[model samples]
Target: MSSFDLTEDQQDCLQELINVAMGQASDQLARYLDTFVYLKVPSIEQVKSEHLFETLNQDLKATAVVSQGFFGYEGIRGEALLMYQPQDSHRLADLLGYEADELTFDEQIIDLSSILTTTFLNVFASQIDNQMSYSAPRLLSANQGTISEHLNQQSFNWDLALKVRISYQVTDYSFNCDMVLLIPEEAINNIKAVIDRILEDF
Candidate 1:
């Protein structure tokens, strides 16, 4: 097994926790949007920092990115990133009961991003029984860079990433959202320690 690789049993337990968080987020979104929200079988990967784009997600792009960092005395620290199509900002605004005019577009994107990120992020931390706190979410537009690039710029040398993707369909339009938790190379041991505890509880 590689440094970032998880045993089959660990992967199973992690996927279950991820599924719960994703399902809860979907339910909240369904009620918020008044539309059906669907989740596919979630996945977790131990991807190298360099191969982030190719090995992890082929559709990764330079678009809307919202992220928050989590940490506490519990030694749990990681970043949550959400990426979506910039074009969907307008539709999202309308869904949230606002028009996406020039003046409101930025605020609309930020608000939508915050709602989606916080909902599931909190769930992930709680399900792990780790008292993690999150910093205010940060948003990057298309001009800033791809999400991977942004992570690199943040001086984050993530050796592995745990990615979960969920989709939402509203009538004729369909949207795909990618959410990931990136772990630094040095933090891998610390994280797997937590995962071990989670597995023991299972």
Candidate 2:
């Protein structure tokens, strides 16, 4: 069995690949909202399941969370957590020219999560020559407790997970969200193999 570790070089390659995918996702978001979307550099790390909430708490405080599960060829599978602050819904709805009613607010949250998760994962999977499928984006929490609180309430089966942290912000608007992609331990070897192949081709 392959050790559950990513070397420095592998980590760099993965981060670069994620950066490209995130750039594409940002472009799609910009087109959807007709506004400039600023993207922070994405960070990747291995985190134990027990410490997931602590890692999330260090990032941002979130009041809303959308969860989407994705699977890819070669055992690459995980869940993506899209978290937003309380004010994000109102700001996003305003950008979309919506009145921010209950119905529209929920719709906008799902819509944004779908766009970000699908676009980003599709591009990333393509780089690894993998086909991807996703579950419907479900709103897990809204106006709830802190991000850590909501995250702790869920159950994670893996002992360790590869966490890819991504953030998006819109200039001139107080709108921002954090996305955490958690890849379970079972898929680490498969991902490392793919990365190794890509490194060889270079």
Per-residue CA lDDT of candidate 2, range 1-202, in tens?
2378898899899988998887887787788778888779988889988888888877465578899999999889999998888766677767765667845677788878887888889988887889799999998878678877776777877798899989888876778888889998888888998899899999
lDDT of 1 by residue, 82-168 (tens): 677665544766676665574365566667667766776677777877666778877765435565665555643445565445544
Clash-forming residue pairs, model 2: none
Q: What is the lDDT of residue 93 in candidate 1?
A: 64
Query: How close is each model in CA RMSD to the real structure?
Result: 3.2, 2.3
State residue 42's C-alpha deviation in candidate 1, in Å. 2.1
Return the clash pairs for model 1, or none: none
Compared with the true structure, all predictions reach lDDT values of: 0.65, 0.83
TM-score, model 1 to reference: 0.79
